[model samples]
Target: MAQRADISVTWERWQATPDGQTARLFHLTNRRGTRLTVSDWGATLTSFKLAMPNDNLRQLVLGCDTLEDYLQSPYLGATVGRYANRIRGAKFSVDGQQYKLIANEGENCLHGGEIGFAHQLWDAEIIESIPAVRFTLHSPDGDEGFPGNAIVTVTYTLSEDNNIRIDYEATVDKACPFNLTNHSYFNLDGVAGDVGNHVAQINANQYLPVDSESLPDGSPVSVEQTAFDFRTAKAFNQDWRKIVSDQRYRGFDHCFILDQNDGSQPVAQVRSGDEQVVLSLYTTSPAVQLYTGQYLEGTRGHNELVYQNRDGFCLETQYMPDQPNSDCAEECIVRPERPFKHSTTFAFHC
Candidate 1:
């Protein structure tokens, strides 16, 4: 029989929040020298150090050295929830009742309002059998103007095959909108430079057209003969010059409707400039938002590195944004009988 990988997990006190809550970190490592550090504050992945060629270790995600840095931007490497994307006008009608939400992003509710799951304190437990850390949170009724009392759980599992699997489960007392996703900005070259030469291929023939407000205007449009085309592997920077010249939007902030919304196979692939690393994304969600971090500024990251636009990119796998205002709003409903369950896996190769 094949021997199991020498995987082990260690938990240590990271710091204490101003509210007197204790925050901790869970460090997981395998025999192959791959290491992952996750914090209990928001079930955040602080660092993902993978073994590279020439006997080196590279941190694949953007992180900070102190908790204060995380407080600056809660979405960095954190799990976002309740509703992963935006809701137009900060309001949505559910069962004939118009519910108003906290408008954290201008006139819209972005990423589950101001106090999303990414800023919550979660209870963490290490599962020895699966070698995973499970985080649970209980959001009371009327939290952030959301209707239901939600009990949510997220599991972060690292396998010997160099795959990071994230499993999410949630149940609500009443019907509400629920969508969850991880916001991890990736720099496969370890933040060496801008991700201009990274090659990407998304299994999507069409992409959502956004309005000036960055919300989906209507149905998806074909990527054929457009700058959004990524059906085949190609350098992302090939057509970036023209995109930047347009004044409507800067970098990528659009969602691609996956050819297959099922989680059966990988829907996208990204490779480093030197082709030394590869990242594959698989998700059960219907869409994946490709954000190029255009507005990233004034934020400091690992090793005192200054982050700028295009420093990293995000592939947030989740349901379509502004669903309640869209044609397929029914897909966003989550009831007691129909709990929320989704899985996304990011497999790395070096």
Candidate 2:
């Protein structure tokens, strides 16, 4: 552990990857005593402990105990890419050329297919000035059936103001759909249980409805007077029964269109069930996917806790799902002329 002023960074050898590469865990602490643990393997966030008023550290995100545990986890606090979300039919066209990707989901390419960025080991570098850790990866052309030789970087910075800023940047030699996000499940109460009682609000007037397979069914629909409406602060489970009633959908797993992309103001906010902590999310992404972890039943997590459905929730900030097959495909494609860059910040308050 090394300290400079009020910020500090510590690390330890975590575990070895399947290829015999050793992975390490980097811990960054801010002035307020907030701690964030990340690993070179998958560039994943293993834990986030927020300094509480009672002098007890509260873990806000769902994590695993070891690298093997994360291998079985569902994108838990991991950086997901070549493209986040799904690409319909496991195929798309780029420059009049049809490209068929590796299908991981049923007839769909999910989170960049079976071996996505989430499962790869990244090169980690500690930035002492900002008290940050930057993880970088190189994806060769045709890797995962994508047409691009790309260099991607994800930096996690713990600022003095209790903010975890995630900056993502990528450069591709060939044009390809590029979307990235951190899949961190947050439980503001810092416990393993449903987030039904958490008060939440989103700055989105419209959302994309999904089909039986959880893919976009049609165009964006108005959220007015619907269970998807979160324009005002309300309990996450206020309309819980309405969702569970429909077997096709278990809970909130749809993507909401953001009203702004400036990142100057918070696009969403959620207060803990106990009303002790609040998290404000600011992003430059065009959409935020709210997943209630409906499929997390029987999964084991940190501290040997067996997680049930809705044990945590994820707000994945990125472009809309299935964008590569939609009319807006061009808008998400990354070319040499237009490199990809975006940022999302999670600010904590107690």
Candidate 3:
């Protein structure tokens, strides 16, 4: 049986310095009888068990089994940084100098390269008043081939409003492009089944067109009558299979240009049945990457459960993918002055 949740919580010394690296785990619970388990190692949200309708509870996020999983999970539930998505050719001309990065995603530099924030150990602080856990990681100058000594802070604030707000703030000492996003593949149906029936709505009238490598090939085209439209709420599998022929994604990974943003407002919404978990993404960034995990089959885990495609989805808020050398020909690269910062609220309703 699952351990019964207690309103009172305690912090156990759960394997700090597991990989000869310092990290800590904190268990937080409020008076309402809900519980959240978090770890500073990769700043990953391990689990969120909340009370659901019919007096039942559920874990609404797809997570890993161990600390090592958090260290090597494609980017699961971690705050991905520096450059969140792919950069074409693993090279970008920054400040008149062509800077090269480690290419981990085939020919592209993906998710800050092979060793990103998701694999780093972070500094943790539990603020009692804020009733939240804040994880901090300092990315050294040129850590991921991106300039600047960036000091980043990711705060997981679980409010009484039943909102999990992930707030990011980063300031670089040098002029280098910075973009951050959370790679939490949410399965609001409680991490137990495929989310194909889940409904989603993005305020996007158009989406950036990409190539076979999942890299932007050109500008975004209008979704007016196309199948890329998500202007209204629609089922996940409705057009995804048809879109597989797009070749750009080869599946369901594309950046949607949101229509309902003044550059600072709610841009997308995701809902699940049985739990009614509503995820609203609000960002000051230009684009958001919507990826339906068509390749996340559970493989070689302790349970031997194969994670097939489309079990979860990711709504990564960022500038754009492969924008470093885009220059309007491909993607839009964000300048240095603007350090990436955005807030996404995951709310639940019974």
Candidate 4:
């Protein structure tokens, strides 16, 4: 019989919030030397490192060195919530009543308004039984223009097999549009370098096209003969110029409809440029946003690294973007009777 992997978790006071509250950082480690550092400040993941065969540590996720840096960074490894992506026109109607949201990105509400969950301080505790850390937040009714007093919890668990499981659960007192996802920019190369050479495959046959505002323009379309095709393993730069010219975007910044949204298998796999490390993503969400760090060209990251374009990629699994204004709005609406729950896992192989 295979032995069970031993796991452990620890926490330390990292910094103080602007509100004078103490924010803590939790470390979840496994016997295999895989370590994940998360902070309660935003329920954000600061770092994920794997122990390579050469006794060297390989960092997979892009992050900042300090809490202040994270506050300024673009999501980084933070948890995005209320709504993962954008909501059209910064408004949505529920039960014959129209609600308006704060518009942070053009006329759309991006990532649940300006003060989304990513900027909130959460209460965190270590769950010894499952060897995980649970971060919880309470969002009052009308917060961010969402009509609900919601209690949300995000738990991160590390397993012996080098899988980091993220479980999200939320309950709302009233009907509201709810969606959450982790915006972790991954580069299996262990450094925030160009991921154009990294081989990747996404289990999505259809993709959503976005307009100049990065919002869904129309219905989903086939990716068979387009630059968005990643049905098979290929380097990100395989159709780099084609994507730039055809899509009119700097790089990949689109949503893909997963062929299988059941979370039974990995929906995406990315290999390191050196072909030494691999990351497999499994999620219960229906779609995954593929963003190739186009705007991160001059951003500074951990270790004083100045990130260039396509330095890392994010596979954010969640409901379709602008779903609240689309035909599938019901899929994201959380009622008092029906709560919100989802799980996403990132497995590292070296």
Ranking according to lDDT, highest score first: 2, 4, 1, 3
Decide which is better by TM-score, 2 or 3.
2
The candidate scoring highest on lDDT is 2
The segments of candidate 4 whose C-alpha lies over 4 angstroms from its true place after superposition are 1-5, 245-249
Q: Model 1, residue 90: what's the lDDT?
A: 86
* Clashes per candidate (backbone, < 3 Å): 0, 0, 5, 0
| Residue pairs with backbone atoms closer than 3 Å in model 1 (clashes) | none
How much does candidate 1 score in TM-score? Answer: 0.96
Q: Estimate each model's TM-score.
A: 0.96, 0.97, 0.88, 0.96
Q: Which digits, one per residue and each the tens of the lDDT, describe model 4 over residues 208-270?
A: 998878889899999999999999999988887775665433578899999997788999999
Q: Which residue segments of model 1 deviate by more than 4 Å?
A: 1-5, 244-249
Residues 246-306, model 1: lDDT tens digits? 7333578889999996788899999998799999999998899998777667678988987
- On lDDT, the stronger of 1 and 3 is 1
What lDDT score goes with residue 64 in model 1?
79
Q: For candidate 3, what is the total of clashing residue pairs? A: 5
In candidate 3, position 277 carries an lDDT of 72
- Model 2 residue runs over 4 Å out of place are 1-4, 244-249
